[model samples]
Target chain A: MGELLLMKGNEAIGEAAIRAGCQAYFAYPITPQNELGEYLARRMPEESRVFLQAESEVAAINMVYGAAGAGARAMTSSSSPGISLKQEGISYIAAAELPCVIVNMVRGGPGLGSIQPAQSDYFQATKGGGHGDYRLIVFGPSTIQELVDLTGLAFELADKYRNPVMILGDGALGQMMEPVEFPAMDEVTLPLKPWATTGMKGRPQNVINSLHLDPEDLDRHNAHLQEKYRAIARQEVRYELENQDADYFLVAYGTTARVARNAMHKAQGEGHRVGLIRPVTLWPFPDAAFAKVLDRARAFLTVEMSAGQMVEDVRLAVNGRAPVHFYGRTGGVIPSQQEIYEALIKIIQGGEKA
Target chain B: MTILVGAFGSGKTEIALNLALRMAAEGNVSLVDLDVVTPYFRSRDQKEALARHGVRVITPEPRVAQADLPSIPSGMEKVLGSEEGKVIIDVGGDTMGARVLGSLRRLLPRRHSLLFVVNPFRPFTATVEKTVTELRRIEDTVHLRVTGLIANSNLGPRTTWETLLTGHEKVLAAGRQLKLPVIFGTYPCFLNGNGVRSNLDLPLMPLQLFMFPP
Candidate 1:
């Protein structure tokens, strides 16, 4: 540990990116995530790094594209509505294989939703919010420590695969304060980007573009991208299993997982067999981990801050081997521990539909 | 007994909620939510939980809780004037938030302590100079000087023992420059059994989460 500090999730992401050797940050102010840009705005000048309060989310993400194309560790952060505006740029970044980090401190949303925390952007993040069939490597961290750790990992993964990675969080995580130890600056080592467009002084010029007019060329490019995605899915499916011996399990991610853990413990205290499976990576879905639980758990309840997004992935993983049920609080409503515990008990007793 | 004031996202509401719960264990305690700046994460949001623990909460009426304009409840003066027990005022973030306190300054007891909760993690109070600037602005707006400083530095869930100490040092330095006493330090209660421990001799306020989970 380099130094311990009590930091908000938003501020921690900013500090983690800086310590991870991120050289450029561009973002427009939005609720629950404005602190990130504000933090970098104050620190970047002191560190002699690039920090810009872009005119809009669209411009900010495009700036990320420009910086990533120039071979610099770059990032942009926003909440749900702001993220919607950047989808076009995100697709372009993904198509061009520009390494960058984008943080979505999600709030309730369909249109201009409440500024309170919600996981309603599950599909947008995991299924690709932009046009075309691109996927963002999404990491859903339950704790602030995980947020810090995963933020660093997101940058490295973005660089490693030359693909954009996202750190998904909600208003609760972003605004809440927690104790964190940032990695020592010397501890982080980044791979050299040989394909970076650094003026091409003594080598062939590197052209970075997402527009390939030829259908055959586009097909081949997408095939290569799909291969990379498959490799990532095979290698980076992270999840946490608690009380695996229990007959009933709850599936959740991000802040919902924190509450689910509490609910699981409560159910256990009552002599009921209940466990939790928390997916750390939302995109990879952790289907294999869910499969391991299928044999042991009689039923799985998917709890989320959204209506029922990740539950679809859970159902696909369970595949009728076990009953898959969903319980959610949408539009900025967070479910309570007691509520989840009761729901699990209802499911276990066969009183509720699964 | 105390008035907690600080910059936005300084964790004052969390500290206030915890302090109210602690005080309620000993005597009748009332928590006043004077935050009119941010609609979310206000102390009033935990009214039911606090009331269950015998802590009286005075906040804006339900019909106007989310209103953008600052509307101090009429019941607030009665609670502030009561001679029965301890009272905690959780002022909103920044000098603008502190402006609400100006109207209630006359009702505050002379012996009450005005604590400036310093969370170095917040961008506005990240440095000693910036912290001092915020403190002065709050003092100016509320027309009351902060009697002491409380280092409540934290990074939401990423806070560690070192985070508190690092913030403590900067807060202590700021207090010395401002000729104010460093009163106490705070750490989240969740870290109690964790390997990290606070070495600061100052009194510790083990903050509890009052905000709803995301």
Candidate 2:
């Protein structure tokens, strides 16, 4: 029974960051997500918190790196191409094991694509857009409420693993309004970063850097990062399963998950046994959610706002146990519920190749 | 003609859409989607539903409708010129959104009502000062004074009678300071008869729009 308020997904992220005690927020303006920065711009000053609109996305992420390394809860947000600009900085932060939250309100893109919502950044997020021997924990929430909840959780997990965490959203979720109950500010407790590069006062000096020029040193760092990722994969896999015992399962995440759930209900109304497996955390991929219904799964159909992105992960998770199919609308177009339902019907009829 | 403009997420599109539906009963109505600041949740997305209600939906060209460009649709002058019907312009949120109205100022009907829709729950309009400031900014950007205030404040699905009442009080205070009339407060249609419809002192409009994707 926290105070509930109507909020756009972008604005919710800003409030969540502030409530999470994010000491610094840096970002450049981009459509679909501009409201987020705008929200923070006004609120941060009121809170006496650091909110800087950096000159570019690259500068913004690097600023986040500085703030995070100094032991402040830091974050930045951007759409697709801007996110691409932040890749190298993200990689540096990942290697340095800095705790920070990055929000990607994804827009359609190979370049400066349309400002319309799209989940085409699947590979860019979960698979490491930046050059790396590292993985960032990425959460794709379907609703503004979930986006708020995950924004709080993202800061916690980022600190828990001392790793960068990303909230992967899109223009639809960013721009749409929904009722959200944010966590009470007093309930938030930030973890202390002993490894932070805070100036030492007679304590051991600390230095934070990403470069490991020595091959052996880099190998050891990579192994440690891998171990942390394994632990995350073990404990951080999050998803929602509905009608798990149904014949056909729809695998989707973010806004596409909502559309798929509607299609699932539509198919159910027609006496078709369709289910949904919505991955909240895209990187971990929620393989166990697939396992929950694999026994009853006739097949798994992956839906996305891109041509086919998360479908590859769904295929990997199903691992040939069930035929994994994909249906998507790319270039900023949202796949309608009817389109998804029709795709499911085709798959059920064995008319479409898996 | 009545035009709705306000802070982002202050329920402009919702109120505008609902207002258009209500006005359609009286005569022909046209809901113009003037939002070019954001990429989703514009009123034009409900063109099919509004059309069914006999309210004509005006938006950018069909091909560029999905594109987030500042280009205004061509037939607005004809629609705005018509005195046989009502036109409700669902302007985008904030001063940035209000900029689109600048180019259309010449086409605006002389008797048009510019209403500043306010939801005090939104961060930008959370305070009386902030709400008045944002409304004035919109006025400056569009070069049109807001004639009245529409207190359509709610926390979406989680809106409670308490939420609506408190938001209404803020909007009322803002209206008093601006010397503008508080036209009415809006409650979601689902909350109709749950007490807010009859209990609130101000005239209340029932909103049936949630703008969800199918």
Candidate 3:
């Protein structure tokens, strides 16, 4: 029988990957997450799984790429800079349309930003961490629940769509301890990866490549990706929230969302009508869902650790129907519920019109 | 150079391992174990092993640093003069073990780095000032300036984000008083003793496991 254990967001992601039937894992050591690697390194060996503590994040990501091409459940993880090194490979994986999961336990950014909890990577994860016309099915885990749940979803969606899925987290989620339950997956096996690189000796070879020398072929590939993206956009938008009897909505995700939820309750008891609308799938953007809620009556505020990155998304979602407002503090700093509620109340009462 | 300090069962080894691996990423680095007091997961335990990644662990030559007592080793003075590469020094838990560094004042680097691995939720959190005073006193005696802090606060497997945040504020302010940077922070994981470390990147050092039950 599989055992139940308490884990941080990082460790949960590692365990979830294992349960998703991923046997090959590679990564370099980074903060807030060494426990994840060490846990897997120590345990996987007993299961006869492949776990390599590569030289660098770069090496680790490429190792995942190689394994994914073989049609296996493969994954890698890193923080800001380390993830930066792996972006080139991430884009390549997307271009090839290969299935894999990339976990980014986000920290502060823009060149060695302080390693603290931050949601600044919202854009990086949803808009494609690296360069290219691609999008990662990004899932922002606000609690250990999402860390385990979304991690499994990341693998499933990546395989279902033959694209990369990202588990966007922060230092808080990765470092903080929590009681978590891991479910068994033997009763629910994922479909076999017939598109793998497990070798094509006796049968027709399966080529996994992102390159196209011919202009027509490249155009066709681009068109195919566009069509697939559109399909994903239509079917994959996801979000979560507690629409309590409140006029003001708090938009946030990842660990910040949980903080916002607590902050909302505290604000509510103080006689403020505040609720939360947290995004679970950031890449799909959940535009329709949020836009539909624009009729709920009042200003919407985006609170984050970054300087109004995701607020732009909120603004785009609300369009002109409701006035979109924002407040943020970055570089490992988080705003308090009082601060968020104050901002929300200020926006609602400020009478600033769109 | 980096300095490691923390309490018993506070995740110092994890932090050291994270720091050592970070050093190994770029070029050559060294993890010198000054903790003759601890039983397992000492810098000495994994020093030679770091060579696999270009990091070299500095061991005491004359074995003066080999003593289990809370005293300084003669070899450290020699280490300060050499400008070979990055170095991480792991010290014992308290002022007693930290007292040994008084003799190695000439060895501590300037502006490069130093860290006081703090797990604030432990028995030390009774008073913020008390903890700060003790840490500062240790720094004063060691002659090593603490340039940064690594909050490895936890409540064993029951630790929560709130506990981490609560402890972080105190330790962070303490480190801030010395104008030291809080480079990154670490939290405890509930993985079985055999589970993986963690997946977040924050220029961190995870907890070290004691092999001999010290």
Candidate 4:
């Protein structure tokens, strides 16, 4: 068994990335996730791996693209605004179909918002933060341990689909501390990247490019990308359902899901029928979760730390089979368990008016 | 006055918060949140809860309370200078974080006990040598001598008696080298009244207060 240790979410992500055979790491330091860079800055050199604090977020992301294109397991991390600056490079990385990991420890943001935690980047992470029809496999972990586990898995998934994978966490997850046991370092087995642009020896040159000037070629490439995305959606949907027999459901992800679960238990204690659906994989959206509760769901409440970004996806998933309601706290304020339980009470009492 | 300082994620904020709450039972108490490193997970986040216990929390102005800039709250000197209450100051983590203390060194009360919290589970403070090195670095940065050691070795929810016992030994050895007393080992309050006890001849503090994400 691996040794169990207490770690902050940011530090755990750094340890996981190193264990997953990440050869090159580049990043611009942003708080909430600053410790990740600090941890890597000290550990990467000790492991004889690469860790570079790039000049800017844009520069860091492009460095990841360059490193990943050259067949290295590459990664970069940033908070919300910094992540916004890397959109063009992320788009290119997705279009080029290179494997890389990007971590967005989202903070309050429409601009240079507050440094507190928020889930306002749901649209950016799942719907594609950059241009084009490409999608990144996004994991929304609620705990520090989950942050560690998902980070290692993000690397493997990124390579499997030959596309980018993002660990979409907010500052709460990044700053919080929890106990976690990491898989043994020897257990990490990396998939070979045969198409990587390593110098050709006895084989043909593996030329990697995102630009297809010919519209027909671009169309075909996009179709190929779409097929890969469809395969991922089918095979990689992950979620957790609690209190399935309850008549009302609360759908949430990340730390917000933790709050929903607390409220769910409180309502259950009061003889109210309440359940929780926590989507672990944000991109796949866990649409199947609704199938398990739709028959009895009085109303579906989507809770987030945003102005209801993920709620839109919840509404689409519900397809009007039941009323989809949203409860949220934006600008880095997290909704309390009492507030959520109250929301559930109103919905149960008002019969959809609430 | 009690000043808690340590490496980042070494449980300084949680320990400081709980200590202040515990001290509130004795008399007038004021908890000053002087952590300017990160905006989240500090004692200031629990201002409301602390106030409910009659503990005054001093933090940055309301306008920039959540800002990441290093702006210390005004009237800190007054709070430090006050003689009516026991002041518990929760400083930020690491030598870099302790840099904020440089500006407050002149205002620190001569009677204050600056305690260095050490969690053997954290990276920099994992060994006796590293613990001493890290503690010295913070002391050097702040220009204040740490008078005591707080052996707060834990792995959050994963803490076991074995983990705590073994970590206590490392911190104890570091204490011996530093010529400082290991004040007490802190444990999670959730584990209180569970028949768990430390066999070592060391005091133990049950920490019930924490700044959970809101």
Candidate 5:
């Protein structure tokens, strides 16, 4: 085991990126997620890594694209509004098949809503925020430890798939402190990037462009991307099932999943057969993990800090086999354990007749 | 019972919250959120949770709690003057934030301790010279000499035993330069049985994660 340090989720992600052999970090300051850029600003100079506070979120993400295109492990972080500005650059990176990490320390927003944490970006993340047919392997970690572990994993996944990866979190996660042990720097092994546009010293020139002028060639590229997505879905579906034998199940991800865990234990203390299904990988959806509890669960309650984003995925996973209910608190409000427990009991009781 | 002052992002709020929770076990504890610099990550954000543990939190009135502007409630003097329980003031980040303490300095107990929390990983305080500069600025702004220093060197999740020791060394250097006592050094409790132990003779504050899980 490595050394344990108390860390906010944002700082954890920053350090994990460094340990994972990231060479460059580019970001524009935004509330909630600024700690990450600040952390890197101090450490990157010491480590002799590239750290740039870009002119804007757009410039920051484009800098990430430029760095990743040249085969350096690169990352950028932002909140909701800043993230929106990066979508065009993100699309270019995705289309170019560049490997990089983008962290969204999400804040509440349809516009500039609130600076507090919210999971409303679920659709923007998993369903592709940028234009064109593309996908980002999204990881939603509920614990600070997972934040560290998954950040390292996100880097490796991006490299292995030659695709962009997003670590989706919120203000609560970004700001909250927890104890985390980072993997040793020497222990992390990065894969070879043969396609990197480093130099053409003795080989043919490598072109790193997302633009495909031919319609048939674009269709083929899209088809290849879809194939890669299918392979990722089959290989990277990650979720955790707690008290799988219970009659009631709560489905959640990220910070909301942590809250639901506490609520599940409380409901169990009340003699209610309640369990939790926490999705660690939001993009792959982890639909098959629901199958383990499907036979015994009377109903599924989808809880979130958003209106009803992941609930749609849960319903599709259940596929009319059982009832799916949703409870959410938006605009940066986090629901309490008592509220989630009560909602579960109400669903279990009312669900018997339905 | 204590006043924690430091540069922004130095983990003072977390330390104050932990100290308040610890002190609450002994007697009634009141936490005053004097942080007016940053809108988020204030002790006031955890008011309800702290209240559940019997820690009285004196924050701005409900009408202005959400506002970005500084609005110190008038009740601050009353709470600072109360004789019933220990009081912890979580001053905002930097000398600018410490300036708020100038107005309430006269009300503070004569023997109260003002702890300068030093996290070497933070940009402004990374060097011994920079840390001393910030310390002097806070002391000047608050009109109170720092009685002690608390070493809180960490790199968030990427922190190692070496990280803490490196920070402690910087604090020790700063302490020698400033002629202040290095009162305590902190390490995350997760390292309790991890074969890494502090070599410093100073008291160790084993920090706990008080924030809600991410």
Candidate 6:
């Protein structure tokens, strides 16, 4: 909300979590994401911070589950595989309906893959990584500012929706330096967490488990979460970009969206009407933004670091009203300006009115 | 057999492709293009050429090879476990490129070698310490060990012995710090020896991938 300072995307998430009144952070170090843990490790202790580098990704997420069950703004983070390890704990956090933040600075892979910046984790984050029919509000921040601001917003929404929120990052943003303004200390007085485990001094034995034995009881729990998700779909949606006037929309998310922004300007410079639509929140996707574009554009290109994971969502948004094109650079490879330009050129030539 | 690493314009593709050809000539070897970090010029780009030489090239199908899919080929462990003579994996540049292999490290054989190809003219090329750190980071992510160093310094088609020597000296120093052995410096050439005319320490590796890219 103020002047920005130069910062990495991962560090921005770390600072934003603190400002959002997050009481604790538990994390495990991995490439492209070690900086995030390092940032929190440095800052959390200065203000009597509650930060711990749990032995593994599983342990770190479980710790967040513990903290959030106590009704605290808690967080944990890892890259792709580490996030995979965090699946079980996340499901519990989601089921318990606690407010918590999860930061995933994604790298290439389904397994112990490369440490390059990749958006391959889209489905895992948006569709829910854990088991038993659950969903988390996943936010895709394309810049250092969003990385910071998104964390604060994530805490707010997790409480508002009674769900888990994740700031999905990649190595490029995690490692890259940029200008960002740190939030003022006074502005970060977090709302009281009624579910927090503050020593159980004033209440009965406080429990934070996700075990519901009775079929009817679990069914009610599932139904309540479904209603909450429906509410979130209607209420919490965010997107950004400056190409509403253009005939073609370039849709991208996370760091790939930053590349798309550059591609948009480049296309404009080359006498093409290319605009970009960047979804800030992956889950509760900015469907309305694309819905507006469906009537205006001939086709929408979903640019990502992986193939067409979000393309399906674009199709739903357009609902076959406008064609959806998929253009992506996979693994940790960031597509160059030329590559994106080529995709635009193809779309212009192929999707044009003959 | 060998993996190449360097910045853009560095002759990694050439060296890796040529090494695969040589290894394949010796036996039924496969050259897998792990160059998921670079979208074009991949060692697997010359799959037809490898096919011509009785070498198998594995490129993931277009669907799974999407922009955001993890490029680790499923069941890669089985393939590496069956390596008879050589299997060359041409990795892409820096930590970004090397990391693709890191995820598949658990699948890599312990006897396999990882080559950190160096070009002295590239940015951040002044020190071996930088090389060591990058290799360490790559090793950490993939959990694989770096076995050797490749001093592959060349200025496009006009490369020479002098440039190769300079690149070699820098790499040797860096290798010393990294505690890695110099596998070899590459020599790119065409008919009449008109390409990469370089003479350096260790065995000279003739590269063939410079000319092939999609």
* TM-score per candidate: 0.83, 0.91, 0.65, 0.93, 0.81, 0.62
Off by over 4 Å in 6: A1-4, A199-206, A351-354, B1-214
Instruction: Report the Cα lDDT for residue B3, model 3.
Output: 74
Worst 10 residues of 1 chain B by lDDT: B193-202
Error of 2 at B148 (Å): 1.5
What does candidate 1's lDDT look like per residue over B1-214, in tens digits?
7999998778888889988999999989999999876657788888999999999999889877754457886687688777889999999887768998987899877789999999887667879999998899899999998999988877666667776677878888898899999888887777773655656566776777767444
Measured against the true two-chain complex, the DockQ scores of the candidates, in the order shown, are 0.36, 0.58, 0.06, 0.63, 0.26, 0.02
lDDT of 3 by residue, A238-325 (tens): 8875764467788888777866787777777878777788888888887876765666747677888898788888888887777777
The 0-to-1 C-alpha lDDT of every candidate, in the order given, reads: 0.87, 0.88, 0.71, 0.88, 0.87, 0.74
Give the per-residue lDDT digits (tens) of candidate 6, residues A80-146. Answer: 9989989998999889888888888888876766767789999999988889888899989876766
lDDT of 5: 0.87
The candidate that achieves the highest DockQ relative to the unseen native structure: 4
Cα RMSD, each candidate = 4.7, 2.9, 15.0, 2.4, 5.6, 11.0
DockQ of 4: 0.63
Better of 2 and 3 by TM-score: 2
A267-322, model 1: which lDDT tens digit per residue? 89999988889999998889988777777789999999998999999998898898
Candidate 3: Cα lDDT at B115? 70
Task: Kindly report the docking quality category of candidate 6.
Answer: incorrect
Deviating ranges (above 4 Å) for candidate 2 = B21-32, B46-64, B72-87, B100-111, B127-130, B140-144, B159-166, B176-178, B191-197
List, in order, the clash count of every candidate structure: 23, 0, 28, 0, 1, 29
Per-model TM-score of chain B: 0.94, 0.94, 0.74, 0.96, 0.94, 0.81
Q: Which residue runs of candidate 5 sit more than 4 Å off their true CA positions?
A: A351-354, B1-3, B7-11, B14-32, B36-39, B46-64, B67-89, B93-114, B118-145, B150-178, B182-214
Model 3 chain B: which ten-residue window has the lowest total lDDT?
A: B205-214
| Pairs that collide, model 2 | none
Considering the two chains of model 3, state its CAPRI-style docking category.
incorrect
